[model samples]
Target: MTSTVSSDLRERAEAVLATLAGPGARLREDQWTAIHALVAERRRALVVQRTGWGKSAVYFVATALLRADGAGPTVIVSPLLALMRNQIDAAARAGIHAATVNSANTGDWERTYAAVASGEVDVLLVSPERLNNPDFRDRVLPQLTATAGMLVVDEAHCVSDWGHDFRPDYRRLRTLISELPAGIPVLATTATANDRVVVDVTEQLGLASGEPLVLRGSLDRESLRLSVVRLATPAQRLGWLADHLDALPGAGIIYTLTIAAAEEVADFLRERGHPVASYTGKTDPQERLAAEADLLDNRVKALVATSALGMGFDKPDLGFVVHLGAPASPVAYYQQIGRAGRAVERAEVVLLPGREDRDIWAYFASLAFPPEPLVRQTLAVLGDDAMSTAAVETRVDLSRTRLEMLLKVLDSDGAVRRVKGGWVATGEEWVYDRERHQRIAEARRAEQQAMLDYIDTTGCRMQFLRRQLDDPASERCGRCDTCTTPAWSTDVDQDAAAAAQERINRPGVEVAPRKQWPSGMAELGVGASGRIPATELAEPGRVIGRLSDIGWGTRLRELVDGDDAPVPGDVLDACVRVLAGWGWEQRPVGVVGIGSRTRPHQLDHLARRIAEIGRLPLLGTLTPAGPRPEAHANSPQRLAALWSAFEPPAFPVPNAPVLLVDDVIDSGWTATVAARLLRRAGASAVLPFALAQRG
Candidate 1:
């Protein structure tokens, strides 16, 4: 690293930046330091800088400089599709050819692969998941690693289990790092890693020799004026947003904890005459892109979104970020609000802390890796043959998300490998680190408590966040709400509150009938396979509300938790309203109750009430032919447990559509089995209805 060489690399980096960020663009001191380490010294570096700190520029410029010196393409492992898209567009501006391989562009993969193979791509952006893709890992990844001039891990905090947003897919990068040629520069960048996360990520990216260069900047954002507005209820939060969304500066994002909440908020705001769109994990990719475009172009007031819209969305001039409910971790909150005020002088950051945040956090925490016995059972089942995730689910008791997460952890740990069709046990001995898992779980609980403290803290909000991130330089900022008089109004209009209440209170989500039987049912002695016959299938059903929903969720939880208490008057009335508004093709002519082992009286009362309201006959109950099985079994097991448990009514069933009443719908297997029996016993059609649907 001579003076002449250093000067030349600096000049080249500046030129790349000028192309990327206009003619007057210049790299900051830390950015230059990172570029110098990567290009001039060929050293590994971890940069923990704030958002909009030109992190992309450091890597893009290094890519340009390295490519000019006859090195291979720079390979970047990113965590998000939106980030990859943004990076590709940014690279093109800097005169660097960038292409991405992600789930959204499966058709273009071959063409992109060909371009990369021919050396037409200067920078290749790929998702961490792609690193574990059977085809990519077996083919492209090897070439990319062997010839890569520089490796960049964007959103590197995700590589650390301690990070707020940890994904097991990111752990696969360790294998990639180990396979890379010696002295090829590596850069890991993130805006959210705290001290623990930074330490963990650095260890994951450690070189065989000397320490990696770690660059950390201040975490404070002067442009963001943070505040918390405690809303007593979900409806009040929605009302506040509807009343004040237009008053916020320019266009922004309104984040919700759940997809249902996001949709509910967006719908409520739209009904109140705001031009808002919903963005969540369930939103179509094309629609998500459109919503992003709308927000960027200021076409919409805001996008009511979940964490699906959180990372890698680079809107420099984003005017505000309003959280309908606080995130479980302060680190996550900082990361989200970092999206705002990036290129502006001021931005509003508000949190509407709700009572349900802890409950939501607990639900997510339950998805962590199961005990050692379960893990060993899963591996023993895999044994030698590769099994698809769906096949594994039949033999395992975990939910789909939990099962996938466990498999990914196993794959990253080398105990299992994900191949073309499915995952297979590699017969590699794996030590279950019970202590480590417990520690992580405890850390998560601590983070949740920190979030609660954040909402209640009267000190400067920015300082509180900085301290949470382990920044020692955290000082009271005069820009936040506590440091100054409240800058925003807290008043919500009565009409808006009433409107929001009306929308949320209106329940009845369509319960889609299961089309296909669960795989591997034969192992359980069940002969069911392929698509369920149309005649035997239950018609599209209705539930008063999802257990995760805002309005009826609390009431439904109480009813389900109570000791077989009769349905409350208000809840019963709500069910009647759901029925009145249900737009089914045919009205149910009779009501049949599913004999509940736990809440038989409640189920009977619901059936009687529905019969009275619809003027339908009260068909006799379906009695259990055998003992009740375990309640929390997986779909196949549940179905097997209930297969012949329900006996057809003793009397003749009406030859008309029947309303099958139940207290709660957990797996929907109970409803499916009961409906099939009813349809077989001379009922024309069975429309399953439940007081609530468990998510």
Candidate 2:
């Protein structure tokens, strides 16, 4: 407790809260506990909790308690528009007129200024940038000059440069808060914050001497099962994916790195007839809202998208998440996958890593850095005169978009000031000299390298993450793939090939050819000896045909010896047909194997009939090298589901409506392809479902 509040001040605060909230407004236990502590002790605390942990409630309750004890209206600075809107809506519902000064729904500047000055507003939510404005300082400082109530900084992690979503304006927050009268409390909240962030928050806000309260909620999500799969090639990966879908039948997410990749993958899956949604930055807000509703209503089963779609998303029961490629950094990876398993049920995270994933971030980093000379020139165009960010963009030689980005980086590095007309150079002059340009390039290079190292690290990824934030050295997380899975090879080799063969040859050999399954169905391929004729062999199904297609040209002796041979690459293509005869005497696919069942059941035959009519492939692989999870899921399921899941609802089809679903949708291409596929499948209408729509 560092309170300088006198008895009279405390009483005034109490009176204010009483006048606002009624006696019936009871706070919850956790809220009351934190509020009581903050009010009685006058302590500045950092609340670190997970989503739905009642962080906002605790602060609001504290505000009430302070008013009950004698404090003015609490001031809140928030970063998110949605968060602000939600809070405002809730406040209005509770009859607590909380006004926000965000980009949306502007209020009369004079009236807002007077309200804060007169202490008429209870809680004010504004962006951090607004606080740094000279206009706001002149207008709002007077009312807050008296040891008024409290100031809250939501999403405090944005202040740290190392944070995922660092904001340059957040750096000036401390200076702005310092302008407030001494003894006023400052509180900050974040759903995700580690220890270093806590320290950074307190120190940066000049609250080092203030009582620091740090708390962390549980990170364990028991419902999500974590797993990773290594892919030798893109085609194999697609096959594995088809199988994965068959096993896990429900609404899920598939994350990708680029807009093109998202679109491609989603389109590929959609062609197979899966009901998916594609989302990305390109999606309209109305379309995004519609997608959200579709997911909630179970209209789409999978969403293929980029990382843009999951922030602050409250979908608690996602079936699982699949990473199409490894993320650039652990922070990004963790946060993206964290969206799943929220329901604490049985869920899984699958990573299909490729060498190309290692290079994606570097490409992004190069674009992010631009040329230092270009950046300096752009800043020079803004001149020493204050100007708005947009105005500076207009004057710069670079594209308007690149100029804006360069401006943000420069602003963050403290090279320029963002003003009303355009950005203006601040502090010492910026030099686009050779050395400075080299240095800027070096820093950008280092940032990218660091991100790459995080991706390919051999040690505990979590420990590496901790180090990134300057956290105390921690032990390795024993559960990661590096610790759990055996290293296969720097490159694919003979031993892996032998193992794949063994997996294929394991007793009770069963070949689920592509011809036996529905189109777009997923399945795991077995690495077995080639059997069917050479011409028809390269196709997806016709069990023996697939085996021969993948094994063609390789001598029988090599296969028998389990020696590695070049995989018949063409056979794994998205299309190819089975051309062999001889349906094995195994039980039908998708039948529950209870104990010693060894023959195909009636249901399997029915599924095969449907595949024939639909011209779809079989559910599992014929080649016996190794089997991925998809083999099981794609090969078997309730027969009725296969057709109905992809079938558009009966009745009057929409007028020229297009439906597209993807694991990731960054651009409209994948969605468009999905829509086309839907139309081809007799869908009279098309809509899109994207797991994440980036911006």
Candidate 3:
């Protein structure tokens, strides 16, 4: 299937490469070949291959191709904040004029955006969420269409429902991508993708037919050694981990499912005197970067993390990857383990699946369908016009968190746009509330259906996954439990019932709530009747949460502690642990004891304070509803000092930590809000302190 590339296009791509002709800028031969193929292809094809396949290079080189031919501009839809900066840096190092748009870099975002619209940028990278902005569609999209030489979607697996990283906004990108001029070549590239993802991308975004470029490279990297161990007990897992740390220790990643697990594993390894770092969604960006840098620099030996930590990480020499918890899908499992053995020599992927993995997957699948009221409220908010997420919350009686997620789904279907103040109906037609509800229910059913199928699969687990993805090359991978179980389980039963028995033995049968309460509240010296007084607790302005096993909840019996407190303890313990371990001594308010009736003047004062601060008051109806003193509770001195030092911008105090003061720590809303406000205000740290806890 030979075809001719226009001389103009041919010369342009070559010219762009010439610009990077310096001694340090030599492109790999494979990179050059990939770029050449892309320059010639007229239709969008899937670039599916393993890691280190020069995928990023393929796309970046394409940008140079378009710019050299004066195609206008290039916009790269990136998935991570860090990658935006890293990619821009890489482009700039090659002398490409690149810029990134993200909340973190909001200082110069407007100017940077202007440059892109004005066709001054060779590359403009953006997160999918950023594209949801009406201003982007109105001001940027049109301008980009006129000037954009090409559209490059990095980490395109994000678009696939079957992909490990399934983001709603990434799916919405199909519409955006399809909207581009018919002839403008689109490039969808990913480090990992099976057959299902390839078909979905083509059908949804209108890509090449009859199988896009397979580019199936060898997965058998000789440098990597694969090993799996059956760990049915925590003692065995811990002992094995300790042994690994003691011997053959090198830069590695210990993958876990939850933030708490990551913390526990990192602490466990560190206590055994191993160099370790932890990464998770909860870890702030700066901390994540620092941890990553430590691993890359060989300063820290390992990173204990969730699946979120691996995306866009290009550390090639990582020696081993140990999944402390089993992955939910084969794709995730493969990707996580694939992080190791990137070099030509020996590395290892050690899978230690305990019982908790299946439970975790089931729990996540359950979350696919939310409560009915939540679904109804979400659809009602998505009415006709595109409204900013915040605006939708003001109109709908739903939590901002739930509203954000719902709108994310609607937005994914191109049914809405989040503009300045509210959500605007955008797609050709909006999903009718009832119909949308039905669709979601169906989706949830399917999710649950798929889960059950995976749980009861008869073939090799790896083979089952391959079939799920509709891959013809599905084979019994020598690894995984099902493939090797017969060889190892000679004494076991041969019947399907027996195989089911083996699967059931994998643990996680006893499902428990994710939270663990305080372990030593009674030991803290606060007796049943000796908690902090209610009057003092009601002094307001305090951030509160639950302390189930702590004296704090007992104290809340007197204070206005309600049913929905944040958790068992204040974040103070975590903070204190960090500070004290670093040699700082501080006394923490262990629990709140009592409550007090609010005075009329106090109510008036609260209303006035809410007005003054331009924040919502703690509103209630006949429920002792008035702004608690906590509403305006903040260290006046600290606030003033911070405001002066940081000098936050006028618009909603970018990243400024807001105070979430409450009378009692029934639920953690107050502290959570305060912390979220701080994050939104551009504050790097949101330390929530409280006088008492209730949950």
List per-prediction Cα lDDT, in the order shown.
Answer: 0.88, 0.52, 0.55
lDDT of candidate 2 over 1-695, digit per residue (tens) = 33454344444434433443444444444444455556766666776655545566666656766655568877788876546755665555444557777654455666776676676776788887676565665556555545458788887877754445556567776766667665666777765556655777777776676566665555434444455566676555555665456466357888887765665566666766677778776666666667766776778877778766754554667777888777765555656666676555566667777666645655555444456666766666666777665334333434444565567656645687666555678765555455644654575456456656765578765456556544444465555556567322223344434433432222111122122222212221222122322221211112211111111212222322242332232321211222222232321222110010121232233334434543544332111112221111111222112222222322332333322212222223323323333444344443332212321
Query: Which pairs of residues clash in candidate 1, taking residues 3 or more apart in a chain or in different chains?
Result: none
After superposition on all CA atoms, what RMSD does each candidate show versus the true structure? 1.4, 18.2, 13.9
Best by TM-score: 1
Ten residues in sequence with the least summed lDDT for candidate 3: 507-516
Ranked by TM-score, the better of candidates 1 and 2 is 1
TM-score of predicted model 3?
A: 0.64
Name the regions of candidate 3 deviating beyond 4 angstroms. 1-37, 92-94, 117-120, 208-222, 246-249, 369-376, 381-402, 425-666, 669-695
What are the per-residue Cα lDDT tens digits for candidate 3 across 1-695? 24345545544554554554434344555555556555565346566656765566667778776566667777889898766766776687557898888777779878997787677888888898888776777877777776667777887878765566767777667777667775566777776676667766666555654334545443434445455566545445655665555444368888887665676567666766788988988898899889888988889878888887776776778888887766666666666666776753656566666655555565565444345565556666565654555444434434444456667777676666566666766534543456644664565455445534554555555455445444444465665445554312212123423332332222111111112112222332312123322221211233322322111222334333343333223333432332233221222211111122443333233323432333333222112223343321122211222222222223333232223323334344333323333345454333333334432
Q: lDDT score, residue 113, model 1?
A: 89
Name the best candidate (by lDDT): 1
lDDT of 3: 0.55
